[model samples]
Target chain A: MSLIDIQRISRLYQMGTETIHALRDVTLQIQRGEYLAIMGPSGSGKSTLMNILGCLDTPSGGKFVLNNSDVSVMDDNALSEIRNREIGFVFQSFNLLARSTALQNVELPMIYAGVPKSERHKRAMDALSAVGLADRVHHRPNELSGGQRQRVAVARALVNRPSILLADEPTGNLDSKTGVEILALFEELATKGNTIIVVTHEEEVAQHSRRIVRLRDGLVAADEILHKNGAAAPETPVFPPIHASAHAGPPPVPPGAH
Target chain B: MNLSELIENCGMALRAVATHKLRSMLTLLGVVIGVFSIIVVMTAIRVLQDSIETSLSQFGKDVLVIQRNPAISFGGPEVWEKIKRRKRLTPDLGELIREKASLVKSVGMQNGLFSGEVTSPYGKTEPSFSLLSLTPDGFPAKTLSIVSGRALNSSDEENGRLVCVIGSKTAEALFPNSSPLGETIKMDGISYLVIGVLESKGAMLDNSQDSVVIIPLSTGMNRYGRSPWGLTILVQARSQETYNDAMEEVRGILRTARKVPPGEADDFEIFTNDSLIEQFRSITFAVRVGAALISSIALITAGIGIMNIMLVSVTERTREIGIRRAIGAKKRNIMTQFITEAIFLCQVGGIVGIALGIAGGNAAAYFFNVPPVVPVDWAIIGFLVCAAVGVIFGTYPAYKAAQLDPVEALRYE
Candidate 1:
């Protein structure tokens, strides 16, 4: 069974007299240990899909099964619990608390999880060290560089050992060199059996992931699979829509795949 | 929720407060002044009460004193005029209590009428010194003892002998080198032999307790003209258990002796040590109420100031709240943190006020020449009230912060 099972989810917003459809019956599935990227332009419902997947918001319609539990109808408190335990989100802004040290920011999630002090401290240190920021644990966000702050955000996301590491526009604010470093870090995490989902409008960031799911106008446009030994992914705008179903998943169609 | 988490939240709150040093200090100054105002007044009153208690205790616990006017009176000159209409308690009332009241251990009469210079062949005393005429039992009733010579006797009172007892101050003044016993002293051109020297009782209510001479009551009545209200009578009980019984006996005797019929109030007033203390509390009632009014208004205003600053803090940290909520913080967590910060400010300010109040109170004690008191009850009350102030003013802003939507707050500038 897939780790995440989404069956035709929909989201709607009412602005005064008009009903705005953010997402309309969007269907998707994600397997364990998959490094996937969801890419689309602004207002293409990419952000809405990310919010639903991360459990920050519940869909207005359809079912969301995370770890075999239907979370679509859960209340706010239950959703908060799921967000804390099952999803780790890294935002584009690297939202570290300005007054807290890097280690304290990293320990924040486990605090709500009611982790003991000694264990929380040890896990926070280990997570910071994992992101190559061991020496900067005591430094606050204002003192760290943009790249370092992003790493701190990643450490905070991973500290609670969530099921999926979901990042929204993860490298949008970083320079190319630092962006490459973060993408490489994600690649290494994926190789170590950690599921990652990066949502971005930048094709360069999507190229680093193994699978790319492209959305256009609140609907899936293409699903691409990059071969393991391929030199690079194809730079193409047009691809046949491979609408994966619940019974029968996506078929192998890329010519570069073995 | 847990100790460690509470500490972590406190650490965050402290950091936030430290970052805005000037704002927090000025904000808490209101609390300081509020707590300080009441604490200072209460503490000073505590000191004054302590000194008054020390002085009033000299009258002894098992004694009931009858006088024409109450010891401490208020309510303006009308009260004084009403008090003046009451008949004077003459020496005959003391004699009646001594003879007829079986519960009383002794009855002592005093007439503090004359204050004149007592001249000896060696030296003379200041004219400000007092001369008290007393019966034989007045020495024990007033807690006086003769350190060198003997006190007045019944023979001296009945025979109206020309004998006097000098206090330690008068002894030292009239006879610097020679013994005051057997020395001749003249008061108002009347010669009397100094038969005894009284012990020096240091002071009472800023008055010198030792600068007085004692003569027999008969001698005083004869030499100085006796008036109707010149005598004050004291009746002592055998033990603490019979104090009320003795007071009833004396009251019944005086009422009948002064022709106070049934269903009529006694013509004279009676006072005891406890009654004096009770009167003092009522005397300070207005001052206490005024202080409470002013301090409560100050504290409420201070609470408003606390609410104001806390609201500003919540608004400023909107993004921070977003980050925390996005991480994992529940609504209650945000609320707890902000309330803890407000309470911390109140307590910090309250502690400073308590310290200043104690210092100010002791300064008053020093001025009154009484032993200093800390008034720990006021300090504890100040602390609890500060916490209440914090909880009262801190909750709304914390609720506001906690109610913010994570999505909208994240996008806030």
Candidate 2:
């Protein structure tokens, strides 16, 4: 079975007296280990679809299955549990707890998942190391650079080992070079058999992913899988691996490859 | 939640509280004052109660006293008028009770004079010691025991001897080097030979109970006009079993001796050690209630202040809440976090208030020369009350934060 199954999902919002159809009869399926991006203009209902997929909201009408559990009929508490255990979310802004150290921020999801302290510490350390932040674990978000902060947020998102790594405009705040570096990190994570989903309006950010699901007017506009050997995976990453800690003062320029 | 999770939540809440120190302190000001007012008053009352207990314990449960006035003035001038118009008790009434009441163990009369200085050949004391004259049985009635020399005998009363008994402390002050027995002590230039020294008791309130001088009752009556000031009749029951009967018999004897008509209020006030505690309670009841009322009003105002600050916090942290929700925190998790923060604020204020209140209250105890009191019960109650106030006031804003739509909250500027 697919890791996620959504059939004819619909979401509606009531504003004043008008009913806004954020998502109307949308169907999608995502298999494990798929690296995909959802793209749309504002009001194109991509945000609604991402909300439904992330289990932050229940669809008004749908048959939704995640990890073989029926998510469409779950209550708020159950949905929260599903979100904690099955989804990892990265946002446009780093969204780190301002007061916590990098390790503490990364451990936040497992805290909600009721992970034991010692184990949570070990796992948080491992997650930070995976994001090349082993030396920066004790630093707070404000103390870290923009790239390092986003890296802490990503480590936090992936720390729980969730079924999907979902990011919304994950690099919208970064410079183009730093954005490309984050995309490379995503590509690396996806190559390691993690199911990664990126939602963005930027074509360049979407091009880094293997598959693209385009949304327009609360419906799927197009779904296409680009050939990785041909264009998706370049000879050299369009942006090379950049660890903020290794180059704090100035990031070394990467050779452009398209 | 489990202990570990609760601990984590509490730590996070504390951090949030620490992040905005001035805001949290300002918000908790009312709570601090509320807890302080009640705790200080309660601590002082607690000290008063202990002082009274220590002092009154000199009189056993079987001992009773008949006097012209209550142990304390409880009410307005009307109560004073009622007491003032009553018949005065005299040494003769004690004699009547001794003669007629079968349950009466012993009756003694005391005529207390103004406090005065005493001087011996060796030294002189401060003008702070009490002087009283007692009949022979007054010793047993008051549970006073002789530590040295001998107690005054009936001859001392009948012959109106110029012999006197001094308290251990008074003896110490009067003759520091030599024995007070067979020594001449002068009160207001009237010299009397010390015949006995009473045992020492614990310090009651400010002055030690041991700083007292006693002479014969007949001598006191002869020297000071007996009827104008009145006398206190002390009665001791034969045993614990006859204590109530002894009190009743004495009431009947006094009524007959004074010719009080049936069904009329007795013209004298009867009290015991236990009754002193009761009077103390009545004396403090109004102050306690007033303090509680003012503190409660202050706490309610503080609670509203907490609600206002928390609401502002929720609005300010909307995006943070959305991020937490998206990061897998449930609605209740968010709710718990915010409530913990509010409670953390209140507890901080309460702890400070309790410390200040204890210090303030103990300052009064110091003036009274009473032992310092902790008032642990009041401290615990104050802590719990602050927590309750936190919960009562914190729920609404927390609920509002929890109910916020994650999509919108994340998008909130």
Candidate 3:
């Protein structure tokens, strides 16, 4: 059975006196360990789809089965529970609390999940180390480089060991070199048997995933297999030496793979 | 949520506020002013009430005075007209109460007269003092203790003797360092022997107790002559336990002596410590009502200010609320965080205002020569009122925060 099952889902919004159709009769399924990229231009409803998939929003009409549970009719509290225990979200802005250090920011999801302080601290440190940001745990968002902030956001998303990692334009604000580094991290997470869904408009960013689903005007325009090796496309050059230093080292290797 | 988790959430709320120092301080200003207004006014009223209580206590316990009119008048022209039409309480009524009342321990009548120049062998002072005439029992009835020499005896009043007890001021003015006993002082061109000098009793209602002379009641009636009324009778009850019984008996005796018909209201007025306190309380009731009404307006305005600022805070932290919600925080958690912030602001304000109010009240009391008293009840009420203001004014903002859509909130700038 697929990890995520969406059958005939639609989302509608009311703006002043007009009706806005954010999603229209979308049906899709995602299996475990799949690395998929959702591509669309601005106003193509890709972000709204991402919001629905992450359980932050509900469809106006549809059936959504996450981990074999029918979540379409679930109430807000149930959705929040699923979001905490099943789905982790990474935003484009690297939404780290400005006042908190990297470690504290990474520990936020565990706090909401009601994890004890000692365990939360330990798990958060481990997640940060997985993203190669362990040495910069004490640094606040303003004190870190762009790539480091994105790594912290990724660490926070994974701290709870969520079933799926959902990245919404995760590299939209980063430079090309930093974007490539983030893609490498996602590729490694997917190999560890965690389902990954990334949303973006840039083709180069989408090339890192094994599959690409393009959205247009609230519907899926195309779905195609992109790569099997989980490597960047040939057109994109290797990141320069100066930008490479910002990342701790070479890209992480996928877990359980030589 | 469990208690530990709730406490942890509260800690996060506090940290959020601490991170924004200037914003939190500005939000707290409304609560401070609201609490300050209530506490300051309450403290002032408490001090005034305390001073009045202390003044009344000085009159001693279980003492009653019978006069032609009440000591204080409440109504305007109508009450004064009724008082003017009533008959005066005579010395005969006092004598009847003294002779017949079972609950009465002692009774005396005093006739005040002879206000003029008093000349001693040492010097002559013009219009510097007044003379008072009293029956022998009046000394003990008024709680007057003689510091030196001898008080008047029954013989002095019965024989219309020309002996007198001098006040402390009068003794100082007439005899100076020399003893006032056996000295002669001239009042109204007549000489009298100074039989005693009274101990100093500080001013009562701003009237000097030392600047008077006491003479025999009969001598005052004959030599000074009566002035429309004979004397005002003072009665002392045996003890606090018998005070009510004493008052009832005195009322019955006075009514009979004055020849009032059955069912007719007595013409004489009876005053006691309880009655005087009642009169003061009525007057202060009006003052307190007026003060509370005025202060409440300020407090309400401050409450509105808190509401407005809390709404602004919710708007500014929209993204934070979204982030917390996405991470599994419930709507209740969001509500609690904002409400806690609002209440914390008000509590801090309450503490600051209480400190200032106590200091201000004690400073005023110091000027009046009374010991400083902190109105603890008012302080407690002030804190509760502040917390109430937080709950009342913070509700809408907290509700707005709780109603936020996680998706939209995350998109807010």
Candidate 4:
């Protein structure tokens, strides 16, 4: 079933005698358990679209239906509740509370959800383990490597077990190797049937998803299935082989190439 | 939020504050000072009031002193007029009040011989003391209990006997190691037998009851050769219920004896313990007003300091506030955190100030040989005042914190 439905959404910005359109007449939908990537260059409204989907910003004119509820009409407090219970967000900067240790950062979302302390601790530990940072839970952001902090952020995003995981350039601050490790974690989470949506400008990061939606000038430019080889796979496979022959040669022309 | 959750949040806030020790200490400074000032002033007033009450208690219930003029004058035009017009209340007025007034139990007339020096037989001591001449009924009327030997009887006064009652200090100085009762002491080259020794009444801030000698009024009048002096008549009412009526009756008798015209103010002053307390209260009321004015100025300054520091704290904690808001904290939550912190700071200050103030007030009372008093009400008042200051001054900062947009605050560097 479609978990997110955006109908004719638009976002306008007023900046001192001029009106700027950040997102214009955007409509899209994603089904449950789908791994999708939103790819765009700077100034293409991808961030604005991500913000709208995450319920951080209201659309100027449109309907946003999340799990059959019209979230666009929700008040600030209701929106916050939905954001806490239905959607988890990962920012490009890793946005881990700098003063808190990894376990404390992972406990943030559950804290907002008003979970009891013991239950919160148990769930947070489970999330940290899922993200492969169980041993580093006590380490603070400054004390950990860039990759570990991102994992902590990921753990925080998943602690409440929200319906959708929205990541904006989740590995943008890390080295290529560390970025690969984070992408692998995302792949692992998707295999567990959690829906994941990543917003990024890097094609390499976008290539990890089974489907890519490229946006330009506040509208979708391309929506196509990613092909591993010349033939179509039976299903969107989690952990698509990293050493597949598709990476050895020229990248296989994306499905619906023409 | 549930009560337990709210309590947990408070604990979190306290932990957050404890983590930044320097900041917490600096923030608490303003509260400490504010409370301290208020407590000190209140404690001092309490101590003074207690001492005054104690001293006033010694005057005995329903005992009134009728004199020629008011005991205390405020140096106004009315007082000057009263001073000029009042005639001396002579022995005749006392005799008439004793004989004619139905409410009168007894009346003792007294006249003071100031600056009288008494010397011991050993010639080792000579201290100046107020020599008071009293009638036989004076001791009982003034509630003076005979500590040793006996008080003067009618025979002593009638025969003009040279018997005297020496105060505790005078007995100590004259006899040293021996009993002063029945001992002869020379006062200004006149030998007098000590009939009794008065118990020590302790020194007041101004007057020492332990330093005076008492003799019969007639003896004083004859020996000192009356120079148109005023007499102090102590009138004991039959009971407290008729005390006021007795006082009015004595006033009427004195007015008749003095021949005061109708439609004119009486020249004599009639004072009771209640009137003396009222007089003391009026003076202290002025002092309290002055103290409140001065202390409030300081508290105002301290309040300003609190506001200034809280504003700085709000700015500094913008990021922390943003984090809290993003984590589901409402605007009221933010407001409560800061306001609670402000009140907490002031309460701490108030407690310290009250303690110090009490100590300071009692120290002063102690130095003056007066009993110390703790003003619990004033301490409570001081705390309430500090909390009020916190709410008043902390509002703007707390409002500013609550008004911060979560998005903007999160984005703030």
TM-scores (chain A) of the candidates: 0.89, 0.88, 0.87, 0.88
* Number of backbone collisions per candidate: 0, 0, 0, 3
Off by over 4 Å in 4: A1-5, A28-38, A66-69, A80-199, A202-214, A222-258, B1-41, B67-92, B108-152, B156-232, B259-268, B290-309, B345-367
lDDT ranking, high to low:
2, 1, 3, 4
Q: Model 2: residues >4 Å from true position, as ranges? A: A16-19, A230-258, B204-207, B228-230
Put down candidate 4 lDDT per residue, A1-258, tens digits, no spaces: 378888778899898999877777677778778789998777778888987888767899988999998999988778777777888878777777666688877876676678988898899999889778888889989999998888888888888888899999988999999999999888878777888999999999998887887776676666767766532332533332222232232343343331
i-RMS for every candidate:
1.2, 1.2, 1.7, 2.9
lDDT string, candidate 3, B1-413, tens digits = 65545665566667766877787677666666666666776677677666766654534477787788776666799878887888876666777888898888888888778677788899665595888888878887777789999888899998999999988888888887799899899988889999999987765432346778889888888886555363678898999999988888888887777787999887878878778778867876776676567556756776787788789889989998888788777787788778877777677777887888778767767777666788899889888888887788888899999999999999999
Tens digits of per-residue lDDT for model 4, B1-413: 54434554455446555666687666656556655656666667667666666655655687888877775556789778757777777787778888899998988877886556776764334556767788988887766777999887788888778989988877877788888877787776677888998877765542456777888888888798764376888888999999999988988887788888888888778989789778767866776776777677767777787788779878977876766665555666678778776666666667777787788778868866776778878878888888898788878898999889765676667
Compute each candidate's TM-score over C-alphas: 0.84, 0.91, 0.72, 0.74
TM-score of model 2 vs. true structure: 0.91
Q: Candidate 2's error at B40, in angstroms? A: 2.5
DockQ class, candidate 1: acceptable
User: Across residues A169-227, which tens digit of lDDT does each residue of candidate 1 receive?
Assistant: 99989999999999989988888778899999999999889889987656666787776
Best by TM-score: 2
For chain B alone, what TM-score does every candidate structure achieve against the true structure?
0.83, 0.94, 0.73, 0.82
Return the DockQ of model 2: 0.52
Clashing pairs in 3: none
Model 1 residue A168 distance off true place after TM-score fit, in angstroms: 2.2
